[model samples]
Target: MGFCVESARVMLIIFNFIFWLSGVALLGVGIWFLADKNIVSYLEVVNHNVPNAYINYAAYILIAFGALIFLIGFLGCCGAIRRSKCLIGFYLFFLVIIFAGELAAGIIVAIYRTEIEHSVDKELSNSIKMEYTFANESAITKSWDTVQVELKCCGGKGPDDYMNSKFTNMSGIIIPISCCVLSDTNNMVAKDKSQCMNKVPEYYHEEGCKKKLIEWVKSHSVILIGVGCGLAGLQIIGFIFGICLCRSFKYEEK
Candidate 1:
């Protein structure tokens, strides 16, 4: 085989191997997200009574997307191995579609992050003061508690924000135990119940859960963008190899 055909075949096969690994990683993450208690808590907030709930059922979406990627990688590998032009064409077509979709998603996220944050923060604040109640066993209550404890944060803005919530007026407590520096973070048991409940600054988390979440998202934005760029480059290279291989077929035939 000439350099073009041989090189293209090898490169495409390698690409498929890497793609398969990525699919497996995605699948694992999806499974982990579904099984994890913290992630389950996040689901409650994600499904808040809001239109365009973007991340609702996110674990399922990740699983489905991972499976599709796995299937495509398998098919692409087969095409490269067997030198099937038709299969290669189909592979390229689907890859292009995925590339476009992901690119658009990245663009949308970049353009809307600041603008969307305002509405999200507003909704979270409303949830804190208006919807939240202590020991209610409701989904919103549970989600807020989880966010407070797990994120090591207090209310939407801070512990004082609870004063406006039904949690304080009805329950007659200054702060939720979940806002405390918990002895058991997972179970929401406070390290010092008396001090924490009395609104002692030392025993409580000073930061706001909403603010912490926003910071976490911002901190990881660069990594997410880098990974996205890397994946796009991988797809682009695979597309190029497929094209070169197709041209080689005609070249060899001639």
Candidate 2:
């Protein structure tokens, strides 16, 4: 019996350390996502178009929850090491709250996944039509160019999506050079000089950016869901260990 209690206490201590490290990682990711200049600028331009804009809110929540988790992990570690019933109880309370928050977030994402995709697609299309231009580059324009260049994609729906664009009409260019496939030897020169002026389908990416972007979002959302489930499972184990430790400590006192 004594051996079992000792083993449980050791496990609790190790779990708390891992939990603390996870909290730190989460905090760092949240900060990076919110503070990155390019991401911030892009989001600012589309903020009004995005529905509810809860993605930013989610980042804020992550930062706050990460801090709370770090504090709870510290308390849990001390509680396990010192066999303090009060601290262990407090840690359990906070763990339960974190679990509840994770559950709520998961539900919200599941419920509104379709609406979110629609909002993203619509805003992307609108941004491309209204704001995209190679000349007089703005943040939105830069963002689109970066996406096109990196993703090897054209306009939101297709190259023709830019048909109604003011830039296309004024400049008489069917697609930006960013959408073109430059040769290995002269990639930089071609991109810089707009050498791939040919608007033919053979010269540019055939697929659309909107579909690719949506697919990317969906893939990441799956990963996020998996991470959330893993965290919730960890919280459940932590709760069990906490209760066991608290009980063992009480039994010794009596």
Query: What local distance difference test score does each model get?
Result: 0.72, 0.71
CA deviation > 4 Å runs, candidate 2: 31-48, 183-195
What TM-score, computed on C-alpha atoms, does each candidate reach? 0.86, 0.84
Model 1 residue 36 lDDT?
Answer: 73
Worst 10-residue lDDT window for candidate 2 reads 184-193
- Alpha-carbon error at 28 in model 2, in Å? 4.1
Candidate 1 structure quality by residue, lDDT tens digits, 1-254: 58779888998999889987876765666576567777667545534655653332334555666678888888888888988989999999988976775565456445434544666667777787877887667888888888887788887667777875788888888878888888887576788999887767889898887767666445434433454466678788888988888888778788
Q: Write the per-residue lDDT of candidate 2 for residues 64-92, one digit (tens) a residue.
A: 77788888999998888887888999999
Clashing pairs in 1: none
Candidate 1 structure, TM-score to reference = 0.86
